[model samples]
Target chain A: MSETNSPSPMRILYIEDNPLIAFHVEQMIEDLGHVFAGSLDSFAELQKQFASLEMDGALVDIDLADGATGPQAAAWLQERGIPAIFVTGQRQVAAEHGDVSLGTITKPVSSSELAAKLELFR
Target chain B: MNTIEDKSLPALDQVLILAPYRKDADYLGRLLAEHEINVRAGARIDDLARMLHPSPGVLVATHEALTPDALATVAAHLETQPSWAEMPIVVLLDRASRPDQVRAELGRVWPRARLLFYQRPVTAVELVSGVQSALLVRLRQRDVRDHIAQEVELRRELNHRVKNILASVTSIFEMTRRGATSIDAFADDFRGRLGALDKVHSAVFHSEGDTVSIAEIAELTFDPYRLSGMDRIVANGPPVTLSREAGTTLALCLHELTTNAIKYGALSHPDGRVQFAWNLSQDETPELAISWKESGGPDVEEPSRAGYGTRYVRSALAGMFGQKPVIAFEADGLRCEARGVFSRVAGNQ
Candidate 1:
C-alpha cells in the first residue's frame, strides 16, 4: 500500500476520553495521509452513534470518558466489520483485548508508526 | 472495658438457648427478653444446628442438652469460627452432677469455645451477668471484623485512584509530545499540562465530597495567569459543582484555551482581552452554558487548518458536554461556546 499506486486514504475514528490527545491523534491521522472520521470519548457514545459513524478503521484507547469501555468498543466495532487498532499507553489492557485490533501502538505515537499501522486497514 | 451500649461496638445481644425441657427454654427466653436481649431457643440437636449459622452472641444449654449428637453439631459450628471468634458456651449443671467431669468433656469437644458454668441453683442475676460478659466479647470480635473489611475497601479504592492518575499523566505526556515543535517547547508545554492536572487533582482531593465546584476549577486553572498581572482575562460563573471526572475534563479544557489565547489569540497582544463566563438555566432540563470570547487582538483569520489547541478545545468539550462546541475564528478574535445538561456533567443524577 506504500507503493506509488497506494490505496485511497482510510477513514479513521478515534476513541479517547482525553480531548487534547484525541485532537492530537486526529492531526496525526491526517498527517499519515488518512481521513479523520472523527472522535468519540467513550464506548457508550460510540454505541449510541455507531450507525451514523463513517469510518474505515478505528484508533481505540483502553480507558474512556465512561471508564474502561474501550475494549468493548473495539469488540463492537469488530462485530460490525470495522477494523480497529489499539492506540493507548495501557499495553497490558490492550494486549488483554488484542484480538479485536490489527495491532497495538503505544502512546506518544509517532507519525511514521501511525502511517505504518494505517496500512492494516488497506 | 467498653459497655454493650457503646454505639461504636457491634450489637451482639442475641442469645441462643439449647434446652430439651420446654419449661426451661421458656423461662430462659422470658428472662433474657426482660433484659431487652434478643433470644432464640431450640429443644432438639437438629434445631440447634439449624440456628447456628448466624452464630449468636452466646449459647446457653441445660445439662441434658449435651447429647452426643448436639456436642458434635456444636463442635462443627465452633470449628468454622473465624480466628478472631471464640463462641461463648454457658453450661447449666444439675446440682447432683460432677461439674469438673462435665467441664472437661465440653472442653474436649468444643476446643475454642469460651466455657462458662452455672450450677442448677444459680440466681437469675448471676446467669444474666455471665451472658452479658460473653456478649461483650462477641461484640469486640465483630469490631475486629469490621475494621478488616474497612481497611480492605480503602486499599482497593486507593489502588484504583493511583492507577487512574497514572493513566491521565500518560495521556497528557503523549499528547503534549505530539504537538511540540522542539525539545524545549515540549518540556514547557508538558510541564504546564502536568501542573494543571496536578492542581485539579489536589483540588478534587481536598473537596469534602467526590465533587468539586466549577468556580474552584476555573480559579485554579487561571491562577497562574492571574499571578502574571497581565489582567487581560476575565472569568465569572454561577455556583456549580462537578464530579471528579467532570472537574478534570473542564480544567484541561480551560488549560488548552488559556494556552491558545497566550500563543495566538487575544492574550497574544498587550491590548487583547478575553472574557470567560458561564450560566445555569432553570428549564425543564437544567443546562450549563459557557463561552470564551477574545477581542482586541491582531486581525484574526481562520487558520488554513485547525491547530492542536483548537482541535482539543472542540473535541474535549464536545465529549464532556455530549455536544459539539462552536469555535469561530472571526476577523477580530476567536470565539468558543458550548452548553449541556448540568446534572449530566455534574454526575448528580
Candidate 2:
C-alpha cells in the first residue's frame, strides 16, 4: 500500500479477448491509482510488441483472442522478471498456472480487490 | 439429396439368383426379370462372393446351388453386413430333399439372415410376393438408419449451442459487476443487461438460420425507453441482416449506449435528443456506415479519462469492424461514427 502511494504509479498491461471486459477492467485499474499501459488481445500480439511495451506488471485473462494463451503469456512475462497476475473468470485455469502469477483476481474484478492484489506487484 | 445418395447404402432393389445349373439360372433370371425384379445370376461360387460387394436386396438360391463353398461365401457376406442390414435369402428346395434338415442347417449357417423357404414347383405369384415384401423391409431399415444419424448430428449441434450460451452469460455477469457502484445499482444494472442479452438471444434464435435483421436489434434495445414514453431517441436503418455474432455484439453495444445516454447524455434531460442511423453503400466494395449523435443536452465536455461506456464503444467497434471508430465529445454533444466493409460486418450471409 505504501509503494502504491509513491509519486509514480505502476504501469499495468492488460491481456484479454473481450473488448468490453478489457475496457471495463482498464478503468478499474486506473481508478486504483495505477497507469493503464494499454492492452493486447492475444499472446501473439504481446510477443510482437513485448520489447516496446513499457509496463511494470501485467493483468492476464485465461482466454485470449487467439485462444487459451494467457497462461503461456504469463509464463513468458515471468521469464522476463516482470510481475503478472491472473485476472480471469476461469478460476480453475488460473489455479493450474498459479506458479506463474502473483495471485488470481476473479472477474468481474472489484476495485478494492484489484487495489489490494496490485500491492504484490509493488 | 445428391450428397445423401453419394454416401447412401447400395441400391437394394436387385435380386441375386445363385443357380449353378445353367438351365435353372436362365429360367429363374428370365422369370424374375419379367416381373420387373432386377436379377443377377451367379454361375460359380466365386461369382456369389464377388456379387456380395454391392449387396443385393434378396438372394434366390436353388437347393443344388448350396455347395459347401457357396454356402461359406454367403455366410461370410452375411457376417460382414452392417447392423442395419439383414440379407434376405430365398431357398428353393428339391422335393426329394428333406425340408426340415435343410432348414435347420441353413439357419445354423446364416445366423442373422431372413430365410424364406419355397418348395420346388412353387407358384410364381407366391415367390414374387415374398421377394417384394423382403425388399420393403430393407427400405424401412434404411429409413431407421438415416433417422439415427440425423438425431446424432442434432445432439452435437445442441451441445455446442448450450456451451456457447453459458459462456456468454458468464461474460455478462462479470462485466456487469465490474461497473456497479452499490449493491442496489449492481442488482438493477445486472438485471437490465441480462434482460438485453436474453432478448437479443431469442431474436437471433427465432430468425431464419443464424442471422437477424438490424431493425430487430435496434427495436429491442430501445423498447424499454419507448415503453416509458420518452421517444426522444430515434433509430433508422436499412434492412441489413447480421450473423448471430454480429447481431449480439451490436445489441450489447446499443445497450451500453442507451444506458449511458440515460445516465449522462441526451436522454438524461427532457430537452435532449439522440439520433442513430445507418446505410449500406452500393460501390464495388460495398460498405456500411453507422452514426450516433446526441444534441440539445446540457453542455458536453470530455471526461478527463474515458469511462467504461466510451472505452467499450471504441474497442468493441474496432474489433467488430476491423477499424477504429470516431468518437467526439463536442461542446454541445457527443458524436460517434464508424464504417466498414459490408460483408465483414454482416458476415458470410
Candidate 3:
C-alpha cells in the first residue's frame, strides 16, 4: 500500500504461444519496468524453465501450445507460492473464475493494464 | 422537441442519459438524436420489462425522487434483467444520506445487476464515466459471444463440406470403374474400395475431426465379419493414434485381405474362422504388426492374375513396410502378415 514498502521489481515468466501477442507482451514487460525471464510456448519448455529459472511471478495464457492451458500452469505456480495472472482471449472463461482471486486481463491486453496487473507481483 | 421516440429500439440495444432533473432528458435526447437511441422520462416497473427484448444491450435507470413505490419498482425490474445486460442504472441517493437508509434502498437491486453506484446529485464527468465503463463491458461481451458463435458455425460448415467432397469423389471413382469393365464386376470392385474408404472416413469422423484412433480403425476393419458370425476378430494394441493417410491405407489393406478370405479362405465357409490382431512391435522400429490367420476354406491357391486390389495391397504394404506383405495361400488356408510404421499424429497427450 505504501511506496517505501513496495517489493523489488518482479521477474516475470510470460508463457504465451501466439506470435503477435507474445511479441507485444514481451515489449510491454520491459516498458513496465520489470525483468522478462523469457517467453515460452511449449509446456515441456515451461516446466524446464520453471525448474531452472528463479521467477518472482508468472503471466500465463489459458490456452497454450499442445492443449495445455494457463489454469494448470497457474495452479502449479500457486502451489509454489508464486503469484500468476491469466491473459485470456475469452471473457466468458474470465467470468467463470468466481472466487479465484488471481488477476485476469482479457485480451487484447494494453500496456497500462499489463503494468497495473504486474504491479501486484511486488 | 418535447416528444419521445414513437417506436421501440431493437432488442439488445441500450441507451444511457443522466439527467439532474426531468428537463435534461430533452437536451440529452437532442444530443444523441443522430445515434437513434431511445430516451424516455421516468420508466415504470412494467415499462422496463416491456422494453426488454430477447437480446439486451443497455439500460440507464436513474432515480427521480426515490419514492418508496418507484424505488421498489426499479429494484424489482433490476432483479428481472439478465446478468449479461451490463445495464447502468444510476441511483440518485443524497451523498450525505444515512448509511442504513441507503443500504435498504440499494439492497433490493444491487444483488442482481453488475452496477456502478453513483451518489447524487451527480456531475457530468462522473455520469459519463460510469455509463462508458458499463457500455464498454457490454460491447466486449457481445463481441466474444458473436465470435464464438461464428467459429462453431464455421467448423460445422467445414465438416459438411468435407463429407460432400468425399461422397462426390466416391461417385466419380465408381463411374470411371463402371465404364472400364462389365457392370456387375465394376460395381463389386468399386463398392469394396468405397467401403474401405468409408470405413476410414467413419473412423476419422468419430475421432472429432482429428486423426483416427487405432481402436476405431480395428473395429472398422473387423465389424462386418463379426456380424456375419463366420469370422471372429480380436484387436489388441497400446493406445495408438493414426493419421488420415495411414488409416485409409490400413483400411484398404484390411479390405483386400478380408475379401480374399471370404472368397477362398476361412470366411468362405461356415466351419472356418479368421483372427486379426495388431500391436506395436518391440524392436523400437516404431512399427505395427497385423497378423491374419485363416482356418477353414477349400484348399487355397494363389490366383493367376494379381488383380487391382492385390496390386493396391502390395503397394500399400510396400510403402509402409519397405517390403511386400508376406502372403501365403497354403493348402489349409491363406495367411497374411503385414507390418506398417506407426506415427502418433493427433490427440496425443
Candidate 4:
C-alpha cells in the first residue's frame, strides 16, 4: 500500500446484515484511503453503540438483520449531526426517506461511486 | 327505514328498486322492507345514475323503467364491473308483455347482468325467494374478491423473498471469490456455502411461522459428516426456534466450522470427535450460549492466516448476536462459542 494522495481521511461505519457485503465494503473504504469504523447488523445494534461509535460518516442498507429499519437508523444519525449515505439495492425504499440521507449508492457498489459519495460526508 | 350498513357503495346484501311508476316502486319497496331486506328505491334517471355507483345485490325494475337513458346507465355500470362480478337485476313485466322478446332485449342491453323476470301479478313468496337467491350468489362473489386480494399479497411477499435471496447469493459469490487461491477452491467454497443456505431455506420453509429450530439446523448441518460411515459430531440443544435471518446465519456458521474441522481440526483424524451444544441461561435477559468443541485429532495451533470461513464466522456471528464470538486453537482441537440475548433473534414475535 502507498500513501500521499488522499485529500482527507474519514472513518466510515457500515450498517448491513450481510457480513460478506460488509467485508467487501470494508475493503473498499480502505482501498479509497478512508478508515473502516465497524459494521453493525441492525438499528437496535446501532442505537446501543451510537454514543461510543467514532465515525465521520455512516453507510446503511435498507434491510438489516432486525428488518427494514435502515431509514430509521439514518434518521437517528442525522439527528445527532452525523451524516449518512444509503448503500442498498432497495433504492425506492431509500428514496422514500431521502431527507435523512446525503444520497444513495446502489448495492454491488463500485469503488469509484463510493469514493465520490463519501466525499459528500462534509 | 333503518340501514344495516352506511357504505356509500352498497354491499352484496342490499337491493335497489328502479321503477318509473311511483305506485309500483312503493309496492315493491314496501314488500322487500317487510322481508327485512335493505331496499333503495329510485324513480328519476338522475337517481338511477347515483344508485348505479353503489352496486346493489339485486335490482328490481318495472318494465316501464327500461327507458333508453336508464338502460344506458345500467349497461355502462355493468361494463366497468370486475370480471368476478355479475350484477343481478329483477324486472317486473306486464302479464301481457311478450316475455321472449323482453328477455332477448334485456340480455343484449345488460350483457353481464344476471336478469330474472317476474310477471306483474307475481306472488310475494316467489319474489322474496328470487331476491334471496340473488343475494346469496352476490355473497359468494364477494368471497371470491377477497380470496383474489389475498393471493395477490402472497405473490408479492414471495417475490420479495426471492429478491433478498438473490442479493445474498451475489454477496456470497463476490466474497468467496475474494479469498480464492485457485479456481477449484473457489468452486468448492461457493458450492458448500450455497448448499448450506439452500438447506436452511428448506428448514425455515417447512417450519411454521418461518422459523427454524436450532435442533433442525444442527441435524441438517451435521447430516453429511454423520453419513460418511462415522458419527464424529454430537449436537445437543433444547428446542429453541430462531427467525429466518438468525437461522440462516447460524447454519452458515456451522458449515464453516464443520468444514474447517474436517479439513484441519477434530474431524481431520480417524478417532476425532466434535461436540456441539447450546443453552439458554435462566435470567432476566435469557442469554443464549452455543459452543463447539473438538478432541482426539491432530495438535491444534492458530493458523497465521485466516481465510473466508474464519472471517465470516466472526463477522456474521457478531452481527447476528450483537456480540463477537471467541475462537480458540487449543492443543487438542479448535473451540468456538458465542452468547447473546435470546430476545434479539427470537422468531415470530
Candidate 5:
C-alpha cells in the first residue's frame, strides 16, 4: 500500500485465454495501484497488436487460446523492450524459459503478490 | 543423460560384439547373423563409444576382449545407463575359465549389467537362445521406459488442469466477492456461480469431443425455473456445438442472466416472460447470435448503478464476440443481444 498515495500506475497488458482470469487480474492490477493496458487471448493477437498497445509490462499465461505459445510471446515482447512476467500455474514451464520473463506470479494471483511483482517494473 | 523426458529412445535391436582377435570377432558375428540376429562386430575399442549412441540390446564379449581399456569403456556405458536400463552382457570364457571369478569381478565392474557366462564350446543354439533371452529383457526395459514417459506426461497434464480449475475458481471468488453486498449475499452468489461452472463442466466432460452444445447449456441454466413449472423463461435454439472454453463463458453469462430474471426481471412475476434464443448465420464465415428478451414485467428501468451481472455479461460478451453487445433496458423489460463468428468458438464440428 506504500505506492497507493503516489501510485505510479503501470499499464499492464494481460495475455490470457480465460476471460474470467484476465478480468480478475485486470481488477487486481488496478487494485494494486497499476493501470490495465488491456488483454489479448493469444500470442498471434499480441504479434498483430503489440505495436498499438501501450504497456510498460505484461502478465502472460503459459496456455492461450491458440496454444502453449506464452514463452515465445514473452520473448517477442522482450525484443520490443516490453518486459513481461509469467502469470501461470505451470511454474516449471515458465521457469524453463526464464530468460524471457522478469519472473513468475503463479495463478490464483493474490493482490499482495500482484503488488510486489508489479513493483519490479519500476 | 536420457531421462523419462526423452522423446525417443535408442533402438536396442543390435547385439554388440567386443573381441580383440579378428578371427573371434568374425566367427561370433557370422554365428549371430546366421541366427537372424543383428550383430555389430566392433573390433577396435575406440569406436565403441560412438556405437553406444543407438545403444545395443546385448553385449557379447570374448575372454580376450576384457582388456582394461575395453572394460573401462563398458563400465562407463553402464554408469550412464538410464534407471530402467540393465544392459545384458554375455561373456564367453576359456574352457578352464572359472565362471564364478569372472562373474564376481565383472559384477563389481558393471553393477547395472545383467551378466551371463558361457564356456568356449557352447552351441549356436545355446548362444542364440541366451542372446534372445537378453534381447527379451531389453525389450521389457524399453516398455518400462515408455510407460514412465506416459505416466510423466499424464501427471503434468493433470497438474496443469487442476491448476487451471483452481485459478478459475479463485477468479470467480474474487469477482463475486467484489460484487457482494454482504456476507450472506456473497455466499449465495459464490455458490450459484460455482454451481453453474460445475454443471457446464460436467456437461462438457460427458459429451463427446469435449464440447457442450448451446441447447445443453440453456437446459442446464434454466432447469430450476422449468422444474418449478415456471413457463416464463424459454430457451430455443438449433444445435450449435461450442468449444469448452466458449461454452463455459456462455454458461456463466446465462447463469447471471437467469438469476437476474428470477430476482427482478421476467420470471419474478407470473405475467413476465424471458425469451432466450440463438441462430447461426448462413454466410461463408458463419456467425452465432444469441439474444435475451424479457417482457411484461414491472416497469423496466436501467439500474442507477450496473451490478456484477450487467458488467460481466457486457465484458464477457465483448470478449467472445469481438464486438460489443447492445443491452437495452426498454420500458417493458430488459433486452441483450450479441453476434460473433461461429468459427471462433465452434467445437469439433
Candidate 6:
C-alpha cells in the first residue's frame, strides 16, 4: 500500500490546457520529489513522447489542444502500462467517466493530492 | 476534498518534458526534476497526449507549445466541459510588473482559463506554487459540481413521482363513474366532471403549477363535440389564460350548457345548433361577454325544477365571471348569455 504522505519517485506524463494550472501542478510534482516524464496539451505531442520516453504514470485533462481530450491521451498511456490520472477542473466530466479505474485530480490540484495520486504508480 | 501535501512529492523517475516553446518547457521540467520531481522532456503537445504512459499528474504548456488555432480548439471544448476540468495551462508571458497589463492579457485570451501567468525567468518555487494553485481550484470546483448534480437528479425524481400520483387519481375517477347507475345517462355527467379536471390540469400545466388559461376552458368545453358537424356550435372569442380556479369554473359552466343541449335543446335534433361567442368588452373596465344561442330544436319551456346541472353551472360561472349567466328557455330553442370581468396575465398582455 502506498502511503498518501510518502510518494515514491515515478515517471509522469501530464496533459493539461491551462498554463497557470500547469505551472502550479508542475511545481507541486517537483516539491514532492516525483519525476515528470513529460507535459503535453495535444495528442500529437503526446504521441511523440510515447515513441521515445519511458514513463511510470500519467496525468491527463479531458480538454486539450489539437482537438485531443484527456481520455484519448489516457487511452494511449494505458496501452503502455503507464498509470494515468486525470487532473481536471470539470467535475461533471470526471464523474461522467468516473467508472474508469484511473485516478482523477480535480484542477487547482494541490501538491498533496498530486502526490497522493502519484503514489498509486509506485 | 483532498489536499495536496508536500511529503507526497517524489524524485528519481525519468521525465520527458513536452511543450511548444523551448525556454518555458525546458525550464518547467528542469525545475521539477531539480526538486527531485524526476522528469523527462518531450518535443510537442500531441506526442505528450498520445505516447506518454501513466500520464503525468501535471501537464505544463506554454502559448508556443500550440498554435493559436489549436489553443482555440481546446478553448471551445473547455466551454462545454464542467468547471473542474484540469486542462491546466501555464502561459509564459513577458515580465510585466504592472497588474493592469496582466489583467488586459487575462481579458484577451485567458478570459475564463485556469491559467498562471509566468513572467519570463520564473523561479522554481513560483512555478510550483502556480501549478499547485491551479490544480487546487480544479479540485474544489469538482466537489461543488458534484453536489449540484445530485440535487438536480433528486428534484427530477420527485417530479416524476408527483405525476404518477395524479394519473392514479384520474384512473379512480374513471372507474367509479363507470359503475354508477344509469350508465348512459351518467356518461354526460361523468364527462362533464372529467372535463372540469382536464380544464384545471391544462390551466395549471401552462403556468408550470401557478395559473390557467380562459381560452383553454373554451377549447376543452367545445373540443369533445367539435367533430359532430353541428354548425350551430360556433365559438368566437379573444384568447386569455385565467387562474386555475377560474378556468375550472368556466369549463363546468360550458359543460352544463352543452349537456343541456344534447338532452333537450339544440343538439337534441338534427338541424339544431348552438352559437357561442365572447370578447373583451372594454380596455379600462376589463369585462367579457359570452353568448350562447340554440336554434332549430323542439319547442322548449322552463323545467319544473332546476337540477344539479343548473346549480353547478350558475355557481361556477358566477364565481369566475362575477355574475350569474343569463339563461332563457325559448319556445324554439334555448339561449344563454353571461358577462364577467377578467384580468390579463402579465406576459400575454
Model 4 Cα lDDT, one tens digit per residue, B220-327: 999987888659899998889899988999999999999989988889899999999999888998999999999999998888977778878887787777778998
The chain B TM-scores of all candidates, as shown, are 0.86, 0.79, 0.53, 0.88, 0.83, 0.49
Model 2: lDDT to the true structure? 0.81
- List ranges where model 4 is wrong by over 4 Å: A1-9, A17-20, A23-49, A63-73, A90-99, B1-11, B19-44
| Best candidate, DockQ | 5
Q: Write the per-residue lDDT of candidate 6 for residues B64-92, one digit (tens) a residue.
A: 55466545544554454445444455556
TM-score of 1: 0.79
- Residue range B165-218, candidate 5, lDDT tens digits: 788898899999988889999999999999999999999999967899999999
Question: Which ranges in model 2 have alpha carbons more than 4 Å from their true place?
Answer: A1-122, B1-133, B347-349
Taking chain A of model 1 alone, its TM-score versus the true chain A equals 0.92
Off by over 4 Å in 3: A1-122, B1-181, B282-285, B319-324, B344-349
Residue A88, candidate 1: Cα error in Å is 8.1
Interface RMSD per candidate: 3.1, 3.6, 19.3, 1.8, 1.1, 29.3
User: Model 4's CAPRI class?
Assistant: medium
In Å, residue B177's CA in model 4 sits off its true spot by 0.5
User: What DockQ number belongs to candidate 4?
Assistant: 0.52
Between candidates 2 and 3, the DockQ winner: 2
Model 5 TM-score is: 0.79
On lDDT, who's better, 3 or 4?
Answer: 4
Going through the candidates in order, state the TM-score of chain A alone for each one. Answer: 0.92, 0.92, 0.83, 0.94, 0.94, 0.83
lDDT of 1 by residue, A14-57 (tens): 98876656766776776666788877878988998788879999
Clashing pairs in 1: none
Worst 10 residues of 2 chain B by lDDT: B1-10
Best by lDDT: 5
